[model samples]
Target: MKDAAFNQLTHARRYFEAKSAVYDENARGWYGRLTDALLSQALDLSVFSRLPDGFRFLDVGGGAGRWTERIATANPESSGVLLDVSPGMVRHAERRATRCGYAHRVRHINGDVDEAGELLAGMTFDLIINTHHLLGFFHSPDLVLGSIVPLLTDHGLMVSVLPSRWHAAFGDLSVGDAERARRSLSGLSWEAHEAPYGHLFTPGEVRMLHTSSKLTVDLLTGFPCLIYPDPPGVASPSAESAEDFLRDDTFFREVLAMETELLIDPDAGARGANLFVVASRVQPAEA
Candidate 1:
């Protein structure tokens, strides 16, 4: 299992390295925009208001430094470090920061999160952002959270975006297609339809992972309740077709609005396309 995991990570790194040059352009479609908006909302609700000036920020698997750039601009007094396993991605992020004149405020590291302790020796952060379903790449959530928990300050927080297992199984089913939805759900598990490195998780599994790492879950919310078509699955849409579908600004805006509203209910996480979790270091008991 360990060998397989390593091989998967290696393959993923190579794949991303090849995609690095065109990643930003490829991600400029409607789905990408919607995901960004949802994540921005999550960050605003969970971390932005409570963020202290001059706090240290860490972005795990922060490909191309997009989110890091946003965080840096939002918190000008704060410093940030962006880490990714792909060197190509690290270079892209570096270039992006230089272009945005934030090079001085952000440091880019090309390393795996599993070995973050050595890569980030003697460093502790106040805020850690791990979006884009980064946790899915690790062999185990415990390994990922274990490395992260020790790197956070006593009051530090980690915000992670995870793919929802329930959504993976049924989110694409037609609203009234009870038969199909039931069939899909019956076969679904935490490991169903897993990619070479990515893994989906249920809400309960997410909570367990955090608790095992000595972290406390502060919030777990759903995002983008309804955006894609049903039956084939959310990942079924091709990028070109998705872009074409979003060309109608009016339709896009309307759907975005509806999805945003649906995300408000806490139970939405149980069936949404993705989940955002905010966890903080476990506080010690006072004598």
Candidate 2:
């Protein structure tokens, strides 16, 4: 017998919630800046060219609703649903939503993501975001991509950031060390948590989705994806693929927003923590 995946996630969430107070007191707030920057980049409203005044979005497995809160705040045009398998995290997300004052603008669901349909039944959204590769939540990512992809409005887009073990950038942590960390997580979800760099993805990996998934890869960027260059640790249950401590200045942010992938997308350069990919659920253009 073994611990269930949901149980494991619950444990992780509980651990973070327990430490949340300490993090608030002494954690340097490093995690907060890194997470905010990473999510803001992925949901780039700039790329949309003509973002609507109001839209609906979903944050799958969004713990504490951190990213959702930020995205909704920046784009008041957006309202959302925050779904997580952990009831504890869902509570945090609700509290965050309320503080962000998007409480009336969002819905919160507590259940297994494998049972997402019951939560998503009869609904559609303009954008679906899974910051930090929420892909790890499912035993079958194909199911996640299949069931949820259809929930998007025809022109809607789905953006996912996953951990890729085969990445161009490995940070200060050597591949061997990363592999060890992965193997330490036990079986099953080790894939979601440590191994495969927690479902960290490489280029073209998204092609493995179900045929009905209907999402076409639009753009992918691997950025400060990790804070390792800055070499510290990751926020528990919060996944923002970022590398070291790049200064938070606009110039550096712009450079990171621009240059991270130029080095890694096709090959490797200095190395990055995580990669960001944007996909659109649309039919191919006619010839």
Candidate 3:
């Protein structure tokens, strides 16, 4: 690896290690709830029912194994392997698996995705998930995709959640950092002080990346489309009120329902805070 990339990777590892204990706390916030809800819609558990028993899944860059646990619990016959860069996060993931009583079915690896090919050699998954902006962590999306795509079974599926370029630009604009916003829109990787540098992509760019890798884009959409670009720190109505609403399961369900409808809007990819994509190995041409 090059010196700059290695340094960046080291920086990200240290950051996640320090934040490991509190990393799952993000799921407690309204934003986190909405994000997960959106991702769940894309997941559509019904698809998993079609796979044979003891199907395998891999969660790339899955921290603390939250999503892995959810999938494993839902599909009792399924097993999972969670690969992450932070040992602290990997430790927490192991504990989560044990506490959840499915440790036997789940494995944790402490390593970076850049080394995923070597680390997970000879292992292929029926389903591969790259969630929580995993693509943002690397300098090259192709490098990440190339290493991971080959680890999929012939008919396997890969679901990816990518941080939106437009969302980052809007976030910078909301913070009155016009320069940063411009850079974001220009597609340059940038980092906040003490934060890991990340790459953000438009939906089109995402499609291009996968298709170039010989994977067919199956589904591409955005979540929380109706409530995004709401300016930094401000919730839909008010912070306190949003917090109250977030606590109300009924209210959250209603909001998610409305957002789901809006997610199919042709422009949702550009308007949403993040992009969700499902892809698979390109099908061979029939004679």
Residue-by-residue lDDT tens digits, candidate 3, 145-237: 777899999988888888788888877876678998888887766543235656779989999999988998877888777654345455555
Better of 1 and 2 by TM-score: 1
Per-prediction count of colliding residue pairs?
A: 2, 19, 0
Q: Of the candidates numbered 1 and 3, which has the greater lDDT value?
A: 3
lDDT of each: 0.75, 0.58, 0.78
Model 2 regions more than 4 Å off: 1-32, 45-51, 167-198, 210-212, 225-227, 230-271, 284-287
lDDT of 2 by residue, 85-152 (tens): 66767787888788878888889988655567777888888778887466654445665567678678
State the weakest 10-residue window (summed lDDT) of model 3. 1-10
Query: If the candidates were sorted by their lDDT against the true structure, best first, what order would they fall in?
Result: 3, 1, 2
Give the candidate number with the greatest lDDT.
3
